[model samples]
Target: MSASSDRLPLIRLEALPAEVLVDLAAGRQPASLGRRCEEGALPPPEVAGRALRLLASGVAERWSLPYAMIDERGAIVGACGFKGAPCLGLVEIGYGVAPLRRGRGIAAAAVRLLLEEAVIRGGAHRVLARINPDNAASSRVADKLGFVRGEVALDDDGEPLAQWLWPPSTDFAHDGEAP
Candidate 1:
């Protein structure tokens, strides 16, 4: 890990405007967002579109939707945030970093910030991340952060995903019991 990232690089999540989301969905760097972005700094177009849909559905906002991950130099380096508001005190998180920016602990630190915000400010009691099995890097991040690995389940698109839940101390299995 790069020294900066090792120390949790000075990065912040900035809300992307509608126009910026639109641009990102179209695979364009949004000039309207007004920040220099390293190549591949934005989320994948599909991820951006997902975030846009959440915004359009009136179910998410800057605080709850994906935000542009900005580095100390005021450049966008990636995207990260909750998939939606906490439902039953649980929320899902998604994050990605620029290709050249990986292994620098950017994602880890970004998630840390997001976690603190979710539990402290957003009142989310639990958090989850469904990672693609092939993505070992993300799995490492989850493990490093103490997320417990759960069963692999099919997502909305019928894709197999490994479920990882945070605050590993929680009895997530009990969540399935009859209440």
Candidate 2:
């Protein structure tokens, strides 16, 4: 396991090379890096496809922006990161914890660490996360991290989604209001 000072265990996805991503997408773990393929450690097929497309298009500067969430024993428990680099000062963040690791605050810790990185190192002024309305656990993680719940909307596929923003703002009508 790589030594890190943060309380939560995380490794930036950018640290891994393209070959590692290809291996991960193929359900293989880079054992040399001490990575383990727990449930959900690798992105789903669709997400992986998009990542590959982004890589091929040369617009993937932030394609590897995610971090691998690790457990106390150094096994990857999940993944989290910005969808891409900050655009217009806003960055979208996403995370997923293995089913076995749910309810353990792993998502929250990973989000917090990413938030710190975005603001301090990436010059990001805002962070956003879109969650499915039925995803109560994800909502809880956002709430725990002080993300203000915004309007309810539909995603590209017409799925109900709730928009959450971090570093709570007072400008929006939903700001400072409880979800």
Candidate 3:
């Protein structure tokens, strides 16, 4: 809920009416909603499919929906969110900005907002991000968020990914609580 003045707002998709999803599925942009979704601003096809399946199963609550990253002008410049609800005190976050919006700190801001939400709302003790080793932009976002680089892991596509962890260490204290 706390976004820095320099960062755009992060609107949880779950807070939107179901009709929005319907509209998105139909390729119709809602009027005066946040910024128009950049090409690929919507979740990847696999992620969208998973979301639809979860909705159909009536278990959508068990997963975290994507958040729209809105610029000062109220346009959605990007999206970010957890892949799913916290498990074993950990939540994995993902984010992307419109190609035209890149280099504006939008992704970092969105990730920061997600981290705050994870701590304040999701009670997540740790947040994780997996980035393609070749994606320097994503790596920069993780670095700006104070995420420590971790071991490499293979993504679903069998491509090597660099793992990043926030709050860096389990022993790091927060808000007067032991890590």
Candidate 4:
């Protein structure tokens, strides 16, 4: 079996043990995010600390309700959340799984959970996902969560990418039209 498939039960992030959060932020979680921190792609200490505070602060545009994806043993193996507004009526979702935990369908699960919650609680009319044109994994995650191609846009780094959007309209299930 795959290493991830060999892991145990799944649990919500809010229920994760405190130590796991510490490890996650400290880059000791063996996740891609941890490596991103080590590689300087993520913000440095002071900046990251402030960002985290703002993320958890409950301000719609600045908020990010990050959640940990836990294995049966209560170990956090991935994280996901809504990032910022793509526009007045849209929320953008972002996610990353531990390198060790990839291919387990965890990222897809996280996206689905966050998308559902964002539509319900964040007053979002749509959820946006910007993915690198070459990042098939991320594109797949968004697609599986019901996002459809919106446009092609440049990322913060100015790289071309596919932009996908998911509307919160309940009629999407039956209308087959963009609301």
Off by over 4 Å in 1: 1-6, 173-179
lDDT of 4 by residue, 1-179 (tens): 01222332243443223343444456554333322221222222333343355446644433433555655555556655556543576777666777766766777766666666767665677887777878888887777667776556676678987767785345543453333
Worst 10 residues of 3 by lDDT: 170-179
Q: lDDT tens digits, residues 1-179, model 1?
A: 01244467777887777787788789886778777887777777787788888877887584445777888788888888888888888888999998989998888888888888889888988888889988999999999888887777788899988888888744554442111
Off by over 4 Å in 3: 6-35, 56-62, 170-179
Clashes of each: 0, 0, 2, 2
Clashes of 4: 2
RMSD of candidate 4 to the truth, in angstroms, is 7.4
lDDT of 2 at 14: 29
TM-score of every model? Answer: 0.86, 0.79, 0.77, 0.63
Q: Residue 136 of model 1: what lDDT? A: 99
Per lDDT, the best of the predicted structures is 1
Local accuracy of candidate 2 as per-residue lDDT tens digits, 1-179 = 22234444444332345565666566665545555657666555455545556667775545343456766666777777667667888888888988887886677777877888789777889888889989999999999889888877877899987888888886542552322
Cα error, candidate 1, residue 38 (Å): 2.0
* Candidate 2: residue 109 lDDT (0-100): 75
* 1 against 2, candidate with superior lDDT: 1
